[model samples]
Target chain A: MRKLYTKKLSKKDQLKDLEARKETVQFLLNYSKALRVVKCRGFTFDAILN
Target chain B: MNNVEITDAVLVREYMQGNETALSKLINRHHHRIYSFIFSKVFDRDVAEDIFQDTFIKVINTLKRGKYNEEGKFLPWVMRIAHNLVIDHFRRNKRMPKFDNSGDFNIFSVLSDSDLNVETQIIKDQIENDVKELIKELPEDQLEVLTMRIYKDMSFKEISERTGVSINTALGRMRYALINLRKIIEKHKLVLTN
Candidate 1:
């Protein structure tokens, strides 16, 4: 529940933008996860089996 | 089970069994939320990334030793670990942290007022920075309560316990923080939301 103070936008406008913001957040979330796997593989491969 | 259906408890079991892939999958599922949460506190991508990695490493080590027994959402559990690491890192470094690596969250630190694409990202960063500034202006009591409630995600009841204030007082402080933030936003003529 990201409470935003969207006083400037009308209800319809707010809904439209909220969807976009949610998508952006979702994208960033995916990017972050990918980065972790890349980092983990670097250390895991080195720490084990070699 | 596919990674989506995999719960944190299940992953912990797999990780305890020394299943490397399971550990990787867990990281993939949670890395962003944890990273973003850390980035918010430290305000640096490189530092956040280091803390993020260290947190998972700690989790792995702890689980291997049969220690993690919390029964709730794994994401928040790992997030708390990352939060502690950031605090520890800050204490050890004894300086205002800065981003190190070139990553998505680190972009917030590198901009030279050019090459802006997503308006929402820019706006979100601006709002956060503004809110931080306003918080600094608040009295110590209000600031502390607000930080615990908003950033730490602690409840009013918990804040009252931690700060030795009544629950009503805790809620009052949060209300004041929001009012203060609203004033700051208005002063700068910044739109609060989309």
Candidate 2:
């Protein structure tokens, strides 16, 4: 399976991979904040839906 | 320095001086990354949070004893403390972490609050799960470095300092981590084509 990505990935693909990782990092950081909020005050599903 | 940095540095110094609020602020600022790093390694949120608090307690104690020098980057220094706590935990547990098949062990699973549309949340969860699977296939050293770099946000230099390896070797580990992750993704045929 490594053969498949190795064949398709160019330098451009590497750049895109890096960009994707950056976005994931930002998502994870924001996700951390969300978890903290939940810990302090349980899920707010009703609040969100209201 | 800015408020955050000054606040962090001040808190570190104050905690060193035995101010409780300052110590709390330091934990509030850095607990997320530290917790996430430990959670990813041990794959248990409850245990992760326990270790997270323990790490801070150790830091506070160390500071009071004048054991920690006020390094310019308080964040990195604090992370080093958390990293050591995690290693100690694994040593004490005497068991390797098993893959959590139910997706319960995926740290990101907790993100699937009912607030978001169910479909969107599920997709996000699936991606995170696939990423974890890909990580499992990476070589141990590459996996450790990738976890440290990505989850902990530690710079190559910091990782080098902590691991006692050269900076270039740290950078090379990151490069290999990415390359190996891409390989693993392809091997599993997970559709990350880009």
Candidate 3:
């Protein structure tokens, strides 16, 4: 939330942007979840080889 | 085994034993709570998402490196990791609020801006050219104040009167100008000095 943007937005506009913001946040959450799978696989294998 | 009865300690043991799904299960079970915790602190999705990822990365590295010893307290352990990362994020930003190294999150904190000895660095002709180009990217109001203060070598008092804005407004725009310039530099990965 950019303070400048929030300061300028009306209540209705804020509601409109909420859904779009949630969509991006959802994407980031899923991306982070997917990245963990890769990181765990590589590191776990390294643990075994060590 | 019912998921309800499976404890964090058990999942940790299973993951170490090469049960890959065990790691997935642990993450899924705690993802929402952890992400919310980070989001509450940062207020911005981009920043919160970054800290959340870092928290999990540290969690994975510690577990895989066999450094995790907090047997049954996985949630608390993960929360602590998130907390520390959040603190580190604030510390870095606070130390260099005006011109942060967004990529490394460690520009001014490593060495304060004064230590950079900008007086000598100003002798580099390229730096002057690069700075001029960067300031052009600033918003109109911010650019006005920054240009006045730096290139024109005008005081904030003079800037406020010339711009017909208050001294505080002039000062704020100047600060924002520097911060935005840093963001642009970080985004482009541009190096102004050798």
The candidate scoring highest on lDDT is 3
Per-residue lDDT of candidate 1, residues B1-194 (tens digit): 35458777787677666665677667666666676677667665456656766776667656655567858667778877887888798887777554455333555576656655698689888878777876787778889998998899999999999999899999998898878867767777867564
Note the DockQ of each predicted structure.
Answer: 0.03, 0.02, 0.03
lDDT by residue for model 3 (B1-194), tens? 45566888998887766566777778777877777777767655577778877776677666655678866899999999999999999999898764534343655466755544666666576778888887788899999999889889999999999999999999999999989999999987988765
**lDDT of candidate 1 at residue B176, scale 0 to 100:** 88
Interface RMS deviation of candidate 2 = 12.2
Worst 10 residues of 2 chain B by lDDT: B96-105
Measure candidate 3: CA RMSD: 18.3
CAPRI level of candidate 3: incorrect
The C-alpha RMSD of each candidate to the native structure, in angstroms, is: 17.5, 22.3, 18.3
* lDDT score of residue B126 within candidate 2: 85
* lDDT: worst 10-residue window of model 3 chain B: B98-107
TM-score of model 3 relative to the true fold? 0.43
Worst 10 residues of 1 chain B by lDDT: B97-106
What's the lDDT for residue B55 in model 1? 77
For each candidate, the alpha-carbon lDDT, in order, equals 0.67, 0.64, 0.72
